[model samples]
Target: MSDPVRLGDVLAGMATPGGGGIPAQPGAGGTTCNRCGARADWHRTIRDKWILIELGEWPVGAVPPGKRWRVAGEGTAVNLGRAQPSDTCRICHFDVCPSQPAPVGSPALLAQWQKNAWG
Candidate 1:
């Protein structure tokens, strides 16, 4: 049997850089939020992208239909929760984080992602 899904798994499956689930494109890896057709971006902190999922800012289940909200500009890290971005493939949502950058990839760029990411 496979291991159960952890918060990391959920985030990674979304294909964001950290555990945060932000797709560079909606439906990039067949990723679909029950509420939103597809995630626009991962961090509202970077740009207003995701909807709150609901009032009171609850987790997965508590989100009310239509009321989903997204974060933008610096919000408290605590509010963001411990979640990171998806390591899964940006296409299938079924891969782990890449440890090494591709050939010709800039190490400086990856370093910036590491600084901003949780892991």
Candidate 2:
């Protein structure tokens, strides 16, 4: 097996806002793909036994949120159930580390960096 890609490499061009917070879409809370600049879906796995026990079998809902990707141009969403690590671009299908930490900088700088890297 190959080594996992670092998240920092993927978010190289995306800027961190003034508060050093990730820019997410309203309601969706998704960040732009570092490869294609399209919305990338994310999900957090709840593996804590104590939290699961406290919430009971049903937990937060009948089913936990699963990983999904929105297709660029097509505007279609694909649900990828719990599986291996995906560090690829949803639109371009290029390898990218989406789990890595984002870089800190202004939006303009980040955008320029991304364009230079991708373009």
| lDDT top scorer | 2
lDDT of 1 at 61: 30
lDDT against the true structure, each candidate: 0.30, 0.31
TM match of model 2 to true structure = 0.18
Global local distance difference test of model 2: 0.31
- Model 1 global lDDT (CA atoms, 0 to 1): 0.30
Model 2 residue pairs with clashes: 7-100, 87-96
Per-candidate TM-scores read 0.17, 0.18
- Model 1 scores worst on lDDT over the 10 consecutive residues at 88-97
Candidate 1 residue runs with Cα over 4 Å from true position: 15-23, 26-71, 74-119
* Candidate 1 structure quality by residue, lDDT tens digits, 53-115: 211223323322222233333431123232323211111001111332321233433333343
Q: Give stretches of model 2 more than 4 Å off.
A: 1-28, 47-119
The best candidate by TM-score is 2
For model 1, give the RMSD to the true fold: 18.6
Supply every candidate's count of residue pairs whose N, Cα or C atoms clash at under 3 angstroms. Answer: 18, 2
